[model samples]
Target: MITMPSIGDNLARLRRRAGFTQENLAERSTVSVSVIRKLERGDRDSASLPTLRKLATALDVTTVALFHPVPRFAPGNTDDRDDLYVMRRVLQPARALSGGGVVTLADDEDAPSSTDVWQSVREINGMFRDSDYAAGVAALPTAITYARAATSAAPEPHQATAWEQLAQTYQTAAMILIQLRKDDLAYYALGLAIDAAHQAGSDMLVASAVCSENWLLTRQARFNEAERAALATAEAIEPSLTRSPQSDIATWGWLNLGAAAAATRNNRMDVAMDSLRRARAAAHVAVGYRSPHVTHWTTFSPAVVAMREVELAMVTGDAGRALKAARSVPSSARPAITYQRFRLDVAAAHIERRHHDEALDVLLQLRATAAGWLRYQRYAHTLTSRLLRSRARAIPLELRDLADFLDVSD
Candidate 1:
C-alpha cells in the first residue's frame, strides 16, 4: 500500500527547503513560534486550514505542497501542475538563447522573416484570447526564438518589425508570469521588452511596456509607484494622441485605466475616479476609428470601463455599488482573463452579502471553466474556505471535492 508523509514532516522539509528557521517561519507566517515548534516536532496532530494557508502564503508554496512533496521543475510548488509544466517549456528557448547559441526552427530552410515573426506574435495573442494558456505557453518558446533570430538576421529596414515582435513576445511572457505570481521573473521580462521596444524606436510600444510595468507594480502592492508610473506614461503618450487613430487613443485610455486601478488600490478615491473619467473620454474619441496598432489582448472599451468600475467599487468597500457596476459589463466584450476576474469579484460581493449559494455557484462555474487558473488565485481559495467554514455540516460533495483539490485542511 502507498503511504503518505505526516504533515509535520512535510512542513518541516518544505520549510527547510525554503531556507526558513522555525522562528523565521513563525514570524513570516504569523503563527506563534511555540505552535510552529510543536507542529514540527509532531507534538500536534493537525493544524487549522487557515493556519496552513498562512504557512503556504508565507513560504510562497501551495497548500498542497504542505501535504505532499513538490514535483521537480515546478514553479515553486504552485497548485497548477500543468501551468508549471507549461512555464518550464516556454522558458526553454529563452534559456537556450541565454546560453550564447543560435536557436534553429523546425523549418530550417531560412530563418523566420519579419512577417513570420509578426504572424507568430499574432498567434500567441490568439491563444491568450481563446483562454488556451497552456497552448500559448507551449507555443511561446518557438515564437520567441524565431523573433530573436529575425531581429539579428533581418535587413535594417525590417529589423524594427522583428524587434517589435520580440518585445511583444516578451510582454506576453511577462503577463503570463505575473498571473503565475512570479513577479520577479515578470519584472525581468518587462525590462527586456522595454529594451527591445526602445531598440525598435517605437514610442507606442514603449508606452505599452510602461503600462505592463505599472501592472506588475500594482500586483506587488507598490501602489504609489504604480500610480505614478501609469499616469506619467499616459501623459507622455498624450502628445501623439489624434482623434483619427483609435490605437493611440485606446492605448492612452488603457494607461489611464492602469492609473485608476493603482489609485483605487492606494485608497485615493478621487484620483481613481478622475483617471477613470479620462479613460472613458479617450475611449470615446476612438469610437469610430479602426487601427492595427492596438494592444491585441486588452482594449479599453465601455465594457472595460464598467469592469474597472466594479473593481474600483470593490476596492473602496462598496459591495452594492460593485454589484451594480458589474451588471453593466457586456459579456461579449471581455477577454477570458477579464471575464474570470469579473466572476471572482462578483463572487466576493455575493459572499459579503451572505448570498452563499450564489457565491458558490459563481465560484463553481469559474472552477469548471478554468480549474488550473483558479488554483493559483488566493481570492478563489479564500472564498472556498469561507463557504466551507460557514456550512461545514451541510457542504455539498462538489464543494468538498473542490476543497480537497485546493488542499484545504479540515
Candidate 2:
C-alpha cells in the first residue's frame, strides 16, 4: 500500500531532472561524494533528516522530497488482502440512506444501556491490549453499533457517554486496522471517531482521538502534518502541573511523545529531543498511574520516554545511545502491543552493534511471546530481511522459519 518509490529512485530522478551530477550535488550540499553515491546507489537504508535537508536544499526541494519511505507491507496473497472485508463493511458501508439519519439493520431493537455500551468498549480495548486482535476486530462493529444506538436512544445525560464510548470504539478499531495496514479503512474509522468525540463535548476525548490521528499520520510519513497537529493539541491541552489530574498530565504528555515521534522521523533532532524532554517531565507525574490511560493505553512511563530516546537514537544511526536507552525499559511485564514495539528497537540496536546472534535471539523471543502481532509488523520483516541479507553463509533454520512467517523473500 506504500506507493512511495525507494529514496534512491527519487534521488536519481530528481538529480537528473535538476541537471546535477552526483559530484555536483555533493559539492553544493557539502555531503561527502561517497555518501551521495552510496545513497543514490541504494546502498543505505536512509540518511538522517538533517542530511536529507542538506540534500533537499541543494536540490531546491523540501526535505521530504528526498524520502521514499521504505515499503512496510509484507507480500500479500489474495486471501490476506481481503481479510479486512468485514472491517471495511463496518467502516465504509455503502448505506442506502444519505439523509443524515441513523440507518440500522435493527431499528426495532432496543438501544443498549450506556453502561453496557461502555463495558463493550472497554472489552474491545482489553482484547486489543492483550494482542487478541481477532477478538478485538470481531467485537468492534458490535460495540460501535450499540454505541450509536445508545447515542440516539439513551437519556440526554447518558447520550454524551454513549458518544464518548462510540468515539473510543471507533478509535480502537482504527488502531487495529492501522496495525493491519488497512490505512484507508483506518482513516474512515478515525473520521467517525473524531466526529463522535466532538459530539461528546469533551475536549479531552477529542484530544485523545487526535493522538491516534497523529500516529496514523506519522506512520504514513506525513511527518510535518503529524508534528503540527500533535504539538497544537499538546499546547491546547497543556495541563497545569500543580492542579491537573493525572489523566490530564498523561494525555498532555502523550501528545508531546507523539510530537517527538513525528519530529524524529522528519530528522528535526532538536525538536524531537525537546518534545521528549517535556514528555519525560510529564511522565514523572504519571508514574503513580498503574492503569493505562489515553490513546493506545499510552502512559508517561519512564519506559515510554526511554523508548522514544531509543527510537530517536536509532533513526539518527546512534546504535550506542539506542542500546543505552533500551536498558531503561524493563524486559519484564511490558504490556500492550504498542509498548512491545520497543523490543524491535532493541533488536535493531543489537544489529547495529553487529551482535547478530543477540539480535536474532531478541527477535525470536519476541515472536515466541507475541506471534500473532509479529505477523503485522513490517519493521520486523524489514529487520529480518536485513539480517537475512547480511548472512553470508548458513542461514539458521529458525531464521529461515521466521523469514517464511514474515513472507520475506530474497
Candidate 3:
C-alpha cells in the first residue's frame, strides 16, 4: 500500500540518476520546482498521469518505472530449502540428460484413470479449503504426477478433463507456495497451470489460473501490476450478465475483486470502488455460488465483497471504516475462508485503535480454530510482533503464546 520506495522515493532516485537537481528537472520538464520538491519530500502521494509522463520524458525513463518497487521480505530459513526441494524438482526437473537419469512414477498405477485423478484433486482442494496445509502440501506431488500421467493415458474422451485437473493441481501448488512466501516458485507453478489450462481449451480454467496470478502479485505489493492483470483478464472474460452461466459470472466477479484490492493498495479509491460496483452486479446473480473449478473463492458473493471492503479500508489505514464495513460481512452462511480473513481485518482494526487485548483475543481464536492457516500468515506475525513491542515486561500469557506460535521475537 504505497509501500517503501514509494513514488516520492522513486522520483528522488531517478532525478539523481539523471544528474538533475529539483530546479534542473523542473526547468527541463517545464513543471514547477515547488511541485518537484514536494514530490521528492514525500509531501505528494502521487502525480497526475500527465505530470508523470513529463517527468518520465525528462528523466528518459518510462512513466511506469516511477511506480515500480520490488516487494521486500525477511530472509527465509534453511527449513524452507528442505521443505521445498521435492516440489522444486517436480515442477522443474533436472536438465542434464547425462546425469544418472533417476526413475519416476514407479507405482503400479502410474497412469491413474480420469475419475481417480479428479477425485484426488477434489480431496486436495478440500484440504486447501480446510486450511490443512500440511496434508495439502504432502499430497500435492503425487496428485501432480498422476494428473500429468492421466493427460496422455486417460481415455481419449476425457483427455481434456485430465488437462483441466492438471491445471487445477498446479494452481493449488501455486497457492500453497504463495502462502509460504515463495513467490518465485508460485510464479512458475502458475505458468504451468496456465499452459495446462490452455491445453484443456477451457476459458474458465484459464481464468482460474489468471486469478491465482493476481493473488500472488497482490501479496508481493505489485499493486498496479496486479490491478492491470486482473482487470485485463476480467475484460477478456466479461460475461453476458443476463446469459452467462453462474461459473462465468462468478469468475468475472472474482477478478474484479482482485483488481479492487490491488487498486486500493495504490490509493486509487475511485478505481477500487468502481471495480467493487462491477463485481457487486455479478455477485447479486451468483450469490453463495461454489466453484466447479478447483480454484478457491466460493464464487464472488455479497458476503465476500463486504469482507473485501473491510480489507481495503485497512489498506488505507481507515480503521473506522474497516470496523464499519465489518458489520456488513454476513454472520451466517459466510464463506469459511473469507470470514477468517475478515476476522484478521477486524483484529487489524482493533490494533489500529490500540485495542490490543481485543486484537489478541481475535488472533487467539484463529490460532485455536485455524492453526494451520495462522502459522503461515506474515500479517499475524507482524501484528504479534507489534503487540510484543507495546509490552516490554510482564507479557500476558496469551500474548506470549501467540507470539511464540507466530515465531515473533520482541
Candidate 4:
C-alpha cells in the first residue's frame, strides 16, 4: 500500500532530482510555496485535482507518473528511447569522432569484453580531444547501455570500475551537449554520471562530474547555482589533495570555480584572477610531479596553464597579456584544447590594437579551419559583423571578405 508518507517521500525525491527548490516549483506550478512545502513534508494529506495537474505540468510528467514508479518498458518508455536514439543519431554522426560511430538498437551489448569497454572509453576521450562534439554527444546512450550491461556481466570489484568509466563518459557527453544547446539532455547525463560516480566510490570522479554540471548551470545563466556547484567540487577534492598533493584534479576544481566567477556579471575580476593564479600554480605542480593517475587523466602541461591564463586575462581586459599568452600557444596544437573560440579572441585583440588587417587575417584563418556548421562559426560571423558594422573609413578588401562570409553587407 502506498501510504501518505511514502507518497510524500516520492514527491520530494522527484522534486529534488528535477533540480528544483520549493519556491521554484511553486512559481512554475501556480501553487503557493508553503502549500507545496506542506505536501512534501506530509503536513498536507490532500491536494485539489487542479493543484495536482499544475504540479504535474511543472514537473514535466503526467499526474499518474508522479504517483507511480515508472515502468522501464511502458509505452512512454519506448517513446523516450526512440526520441533519445534519434537525437543521438542526429546530433552525433559516426564520422564526427574517432571510434565506433553509432549504436544500433540491434547491437549486441551482452558480449562486450573488458578490452572492448576500455577501447570504447579511449575513443570517447579522443572524440573530446578532437572537439568532435556531436559524436561525443551521440555516444552517451551507448556508453550508459554498456555500463549497465557491464555491471550484470562483471563480477563484484570489476563492476565498480565499470561504473566509474561510465560516469566519466556520461560527464563528457553532458559537457558536449551543453555546448550544443541541449540543456535537458545535459542535465540528465550529468545526473546519471553523478549517481554512477557515487556508486563507484570514486571521489575524484564525483568531483569531475560536478564540474561538468557546474558548467551546464553557468550556461543556463544560473550563476548562484554554478558557483555553489563549483565550490562544492573544489571542497570535495581539497581534503584528498592535502594528503596526496594531486594538483591536476585539485586545479580542475579551482579552474572551474574561477570560470564560474569570471562568467558572472557581478564577479570581481581581482578575485577571479586570484583563483586562476592558484589554479595555474596547482596545474604546474601536477605537471611537474607526474603522478600516474594524474598523468593518465588530469595532466595539465605548461601549455594548458598558459592558455587558461590567457583566457582569463582576455576576460579581465588585459589585452597585452592576453596577446602574449596567445602567442605562447602554437596555433596547430591549441585548437584541440580551446576549440575555434580562441580565434575570435585573437581577432578581438587585434581590433583593439587598431590592427583590422591582422584581425581580418585571424578571422580568415578561422573560417578556413573550423567547419561551417559549428556554433563557433556563427559566433565568428556575428563578431565580424559587429566589427564591420560601423567603420569611420572605407572598408578594406580583406575585411569585405569577412563580411561576405557572414552574409552581411556594410
Name the lDDT of candidate 3. 0.77
Mark the regions of model 4 whose C-alpha exceeds 4 Å error after superposition: 1-110, 137-140, 239-264, 288-297, 332-335, 372-374, 390-410
**What lDDT is obtained when candidate 1 is compared to the true structure?**
0.71
With a 3 Å backbone cut-off (N, CA, C), the pairs that clash in candidate 2 are none
lDDT string, candidate 4, 1-410, tens digits:
21112335666777888899988988988777776766677664334333455777898875544434321211112244433453455334567465433332222423545555665566556655655554444444455455455656678868777777667667767765565556787787788778888988887777767666765676567866776666656755664344565644544634454454535334655555555665665655555443332112354555655666665566667778878888876664432435356667777777767777787787777666654333334456666776786467888787787677566656
TM-scores, in order shown?
0.73, 0.76, 0.77, 0.64
Per-residue lDDT of model 3, residues 1-410, tens digit only: 32323567888999999999999999999877876777787765444434555888999996557655523223344345545555676688777654311213323233466666767677667767777654555456556766776786768788788898899989888887777678898899999999998998988878888888988899889999999989998999899988998888988888999999999989898999999999899899998677664655446788888898889889988999999888877666355677888898899999899988889899999999888778778788888888888775799999988887777898
Backbone clashes for every candidate come to 0, 0, 0, 0
Among all candidates shown, the one with the greatest lDDT: 3
Poorly placed runs, candidate 1 (over 4 Å): 1-103, 106-109, 130-135, 239-244, 287-298
- On the 0 to 100 scale, the lDDT of residue 387 in model 4 is 70
Best by TM-score: 3
lDDT for 372 (candidate 1)? 65
lDDT of 3 at 46: 46
User: Model 1, range 198-284, lDDT digits (tens) per residue?
Assistant: 999987888888888887898888999999988888888784445336677777887888899999898897889899999888766
Candidate with more favorable, higher lDDT: 1 or 3: 3
Cα lDDT tens digits for candidate 2, 219-242? 999999999999998999899877
Sequence-dependent TM-score of model 3: 0.77
